[model samples]
Target: MLYSYAGHILVIDLTTGNIEKQELNEDYARQYVGGRGLGARYLYDLLKPGIDALSPDNILIMMTGPFTATGIYACQKYEWVTKSPLTNIYLCNNTGGSFGVRLKESGYDGIIIKGASNTPKYILIDGDNVDLQDASSVWGKKVSETQRAIYEMTKADTIVCTGSSADLPNPVKFAGVYDGHRCSGRGGLGAVFGSKNLKAIAVMKPNKKIEPKIYNPSGLKDELSELIKDIKKNEVTGEQLPKFGSIIWMDTTAQFGILPTRNYQDILTYEDIEGKIDTTGYGKKVVKSKELKAINCLDCPILSGHVVIPDHGEWAGKPTKGPEFETSWALGANLGIIDFGHIISANKECNEYGIDTISTGVAIGFAMECRQKGLINDDILEWGNSESVIKMIGKIANREGWLGDTLADGVRSASEKIGNGSNSFALHVKGLEVPAYDPRGVWGMALTYATSIRGACHLKSWTVAAENSKDYIPVSTEKKAKLVKDIQDLRSVMDSLIVCFFAGRAINKDWIVRLVNVVTDFDWTPEKLDEIGARIYDLERMISVREGITSKDDLLPHRIMEEPLNNGQWKGKKITKENMEIMLREYYKLRNWDENGIPKRSV
Candidate 1:
């Protein structure tokens, strides 16, 4: 009997409206673990290279880890894997909500969706009853509305639905969650769903709990208690997170010279400007004045997500989940907008429209830079204009005319289309825009952004914590490659286990091993899991390599490498070409790859 997993896979073809259930491959599970790792392996096995990412040929897999629905801290997360419609490469995005837990309880390990429907539809999984129903009734609605409608129609406990943005002629690169404020908000997966004519996926909680077998329930309980205790004890996860939320890093980033301000043309050097948007500044001006409260995911120990409500002004009395560090940086500092109220409103608008805040913010930043450089003559878009930022959110979601359509295509595609040296300023890696972390200030991120399979993703290897914390691993080229590789491998393990990275920060590898042992039949050690991580990373890289990504493509934008920070304590700091070459050579060597970053045949 399978332990800690449902041991079944569901397949739905939108073209024929057929459903198929298949047994999980134990060998794949053992090698790749689950979640991110399992998703990568399955994609590699199922797909060939060079298919149109928006075409029916492209596949999407929704996967959960062994720890999902097991009452473990941060196990409520699940991941979506697909060839990105934005990047045309492999992509994996995770979201936190009750959908994953309900999915597992419904007795399926994961679901693979393929083919495009002749018309718009939504998937309904009510215990054994699964069907593709017409979505025309709800297709054009906003995220919250679509979710509410789906819940009302299906009475499902959990739902993942696309926003109206997905139905646009040029769908924006993100989508929202209906179950909670969670979102699968990256790599334009929502646009892929739109391309496939899928509106939403609604899941009902299992009538009866189908608990995965556990070897030692009592021991597992004790381990869980210890983990919870450890989390509560950790200052960052327990105190700081619950108190300030993820935006706590705004102050740190500002100090470290990593905060991307004014489209990254300058770092946070001005005290007055920094003080306006920094954590304390925001707390006083926004949260305190508005009386917004903090909220956590279901059973989440660290309440990193907070509800934002403004007491006065345009967005007064409106509530939204967050403008996390990245969101705040992208829409706030990057745009030169310091009003916390405006930032909060923009965050809410982005969520409602089912847009990826990072991508949308970057797209806007790119547009502002382009306009500044006379590359485009967009009157509606200007740097530091919060009003314009808020308006563009709706325009982009609806694909309103040239500006909206162009922005919806993402920074890389948009820049390439409107070239007059725009690509030089377009901040992206492998077609995906970079997140808020400025790689120049945090040197390790250069390698992280360059080599990440999902293109300029921070979560793939979040080494910034090491750089900022007392880990002693300085953000330098000398040690960054090894540091990045190690973190990537470790994160691979965590992602497979489906533990939130925040929780992983508090728990150690040994604790994770114990959790696995108590829940699964396999006796996995730290060393074994580390090997699995390496395998997972290698497999994901291989998929990209197969898609024709070369060492040349494994690079950051010229702005990050060539242009030095003009201001701040990190003035003149940039990842020089030589520095990147050294780091890449070392990183490839450590990964057993050739000079061109192709994995050796033995690997």
Candidate 2:
């Protein structure tokens, strides 16, 4: 059999103390690609609905995409997924760092971990050799501290760990880490690690090859060489994101009235900030991660890094990494705190703890709203009280109190506890908490958030780009469904190719195909690629539907429908139930899904 991948997939059953390696099957490789899409395929094949998320039966997967370790922009992320204790659906959390490259070098495209371990131990991979280390000393260490200690022991090796004190017995209090900087950052992947008595995964593979070309670019080598050259020659990455890192969009979202403020009850526009959120040469505020510093991936050169916030308060001098678009929207404006340091530090803590920062921020925001309304108490939560917030983080990782315990369930499940009116604003698509954007104003986002298999993830398909495209009006619904659907198909294709979501749109589909063609001579036509994307998307939907979701589960929160942007560029805009339903039906029809949003089997 021909091996297209330089690496293999390693499956370790901690419970059984068995380890095996499987070569990448070309059929599966071409179909699912890597990262989220591959994760779904793996889960679809292995997962049985309603299994306990924290059980030894749950298989935790650490996966990377095809472009990992190749020179591809924003292609640095790796996926960590399981039956999410948060969403209860297929959940894949990605972290961008050097881990993907390391994972590839360790001779695995992905790692599937099953069976629970009885002792606090870590899985260490130094090239092909694997060891189960005693992590008793490393247990309860923060991700940063653990990284330092473990790396010190391993002599500066790249490490991903979840021994942080944040891991509790339940999802409410679970956090894990990818490295010191990036985080899987969601869905209690860390807690699962803790439950398994698994402390960390240390990967120290330095020299490894992960790319195997299935299509050749030779045919288009001369023809499309100019485009590749153009991309290389330009400082597009440097010019757009330098200094601010992902936080560059902070003030911009505020200007557009999309910044979620006060728990989605209001949009904190540039007017509300009143120059407090001013854009500087660095960004609108203190840049936590700087794009000027590095556009690091395995081999890509689009410098993106945390802008190093000079900290204060409990997190004084704490250099937080990102409030990138997601963190910015969820933590910064969503909770009505313009304190950049606080925002950065919170995200930093989430990263260190190995929890999804978006959900943490949103969960806290919901808690704050509940507190203010007397639905809950300051004893439970206090707005802008960083101490309480920090405590809540601890409580969540520890599942300390009732509210914290409830919140560990995430916004969708947690909201159910509020009993009345709270469910209306629970703000989630598929149980994953919504990021900062309020879809009420951005019509395309309504669909994006609603249909996202992982609940409000913008990565699955970025229709907002088309809606905000220079070619179309931002708010119009006409042609939106077609544009969104097309993008979704294209996105699925790029995902299999394992490039960054940003790159999926930054470069054209034809260019990507050509790039792949150069590496492998496969005749990957755009139409065929789209079909592949559609099929994967359909399969993911099937996974969701099989797990018991229906058209009813595909609806947005009522607050987004009831609320309008009270000020700024977007005003008097609110998506009605009828309007949203129509758009959804249209979207389903375009995808060959039934009225209930189920994909036709023949499709």
Q: Write the per-residue lDDT of candidate 2 for residues 1-603, one digit (tens) a residue.
A: 222344478889898788888876666776676776777788788878878777888878878776665544556567776776666666666666777777775678888888888877888887767777888888877777788888877753667787454445453433555665666666667777877888888887555544444343345346345654544554445454544455556655666567767788767766666555434422544543444243244445555554456364455565455456677556666776666666666766666666667887888888888788778766736655666666776666556678877887787777787876788778777777777666766688888778876667777766654566687666666776777778777776666556665444346787777665555445577877777788878887887787788888887877777667675577778888877777888898999999988898642
Q: Give the runs in model 2 whose Cα sits over 4 Å from its true position.
A: 1-4, 163-166, 173-176, 206-236, 278-299, 318-322, 379-388
Q: What is the C-alpha lDDT of each candidate?
A: 0.82, 0.69
Per-model TM values vs. the true structure: 0.96, 0.90
Q: How far off is residue 357 in model 2, in Å?
A: 1.9
- Model 1, 451-556: lDDT tens per residue? 9989999998887778766754444776888889998998888888788877777877888898999988779888998888889999988888889987999899
- Highest TM-score among the candidates is held by which one? 1
What candidate 1 gets wrong by more than 4 Å, as runs, is 174-179, 270-275, 285-295, 310-315, 468-475, 601-603
